[model samples]
Target: MLDLHHIFAMQKKALFFLLALCALGWGFTSYPTVFAGIAIGACFGTYNFWILVRRMDKFDRSISEGRKVASLGSALRFGSGIAAVAIAITLPEYFHLISAVIGLMVPYVFLFIGVFVSSVRNKGN
Candidate 1:
């Protein structure tokens, strides 16, 4: 019911575009660290997003079967975000902490945008 595959495809496309922008910034701009941080965070963010979607799909299945599911793996996702931050902190010369933090949120931003666009498209049909 959720069209999860389509959602993931859209998100992947958006993240790839973002990575391209990060590449450009890293190459052309003065703040290479900032772009690098964003790129790193986005990569981790994409992984986290995939995990969430996969868990959600399982959750839906569990519900349909009248069974109990463990959780959405918040701990795993939290650890991932922490790991990204840790990487940034460990490499202070190569990555900006604030930018990495912002980058971690990029996937959710794209998710919201994609949902909004899909909703609008559906309404138009």
Candidate 2:
């Protein structure tokens, strides 16, 4: 089984770095709205990521204990993503809708990258 804690840690680090970049973009670039959108989306994405991790842990525990696992809260995550989009839509001047959508995908991107890196390192070892 994969180490959830380690994976989550890796993702958190990546997300923080991304947030820093967004901050810089907001401060130095003309497209402050775009960066702000991304930052907001990323915050929601991080929340979703944390929820997924918690659900996954519960799932693993249920499996080990021979109990049925509940749903993974996909709907909740989906709703949050929608809420991010809605926020951008409602505040058009403050956020770019497209950029907000892109921000919502940040965590998943980091997830894949982290897994790939982990696999490569394991292989090397």
Candidate 3:
């Protein structure tokens, strides 16, 4: 029931949230530590991104095109989960304990957003 525009909008919001987090880290954390966190985060993000991409590709191949099994919202949720874990791993060493806690929550936020959007669309249909 979800469309491309809905997916894109969610992605845009997520990216903006990420950028805001980065800015907050830069503003509060020391430069060297923030840089290290960024490096670690990027590495983790890249690794997980590839893994999720492969999984999604497999899902796409297995599912019928007419069926909405692995939609873009699902993809975003997966990506956000990966991102949250990455941030949790990367930021704890450099940022405050609270930031790390917030990082851990990112995946759930994305998951809820995805489910809410999907449910709304499905109900509308």
Candidate 4:
């Protein structure tokens, strides 16, 4: 069985790689506004993920102990992205809304990469 912790570690590395990718974005896109938008999204995604993990941990523990705790991570994650997009759209002259929207998907990008690599690697068995 694939180690879950190992997978999460890979995910973390991928998120950091996304951050590094921002430098490439800034250098290649020649639009600091877009890059800034992406950077903001990527940073927020990282924080959102961290918050999600913690919230899940707490919720899981509560469940194991036969209790229920409301999980707000999902709302927070969506809320932050929507808020960022709103900010970007409202300040068209400052940030590229499209890029910001794309940037918010950084986590999913890493998620697909992890799943693809894991499936391909395990297929050799």
TM-score of each: 0.93, 0.93, 0.42, 0.78
Residue 23's lDDT within candidate 4 is 75
Worst 10 residues of 3 by lDDT: 39-48
Note the residue pairs that clash in candidate 1: none
**Model 4 TM-score, 2 decimals:** 0.78
- For model 3 the TM-score comes to 0.42
Error of 2 at 86 (Å): 0.7
Per-model C-alpha RMSD: 1.4, 1.3, 7.3, 2.5
7, model 1: CA deviation in Å?
Answer: 1.1
* Ranking of models by TM-score: 1, 2, 4, 3
- After superposition, the stretches of candidate 2 with alpha carbons farther than 4 Å from their true spots are none
lDDT by residue (56-111, candidate 1, tens digit) is 98999999999998699899999999999999999999999999999999988988
Q: RMSD, model 3, all Cα superposed?
A: 7.3
User: Candidate 4 at 79: error in angstroms?
Assistant: 1.9
Candidate 2: minimum summed lDDT over ten consecutive residues — where? Answer: 1-10
Q: lDDT of all predictions, in order shown? A: 0.92, 0.91, 0.54, 0.75
- 57 Cα displacement, candidate 4 (Å): 1.2
C-alpha positional error of residue 62 in candidate 3 after TM-score superposition, expressed in Å: 6.0
Model 2 lDDT at residue 24: 100
Which TM-score value belongs to model 1? Answer: 0.93
Q: Tens digits of per-residue lDDT for model 3 on 1-125?
A: 45434554564467556757677767786664554344344434433434555556667765856665654345664565566555656656664334444444443455468878789988899
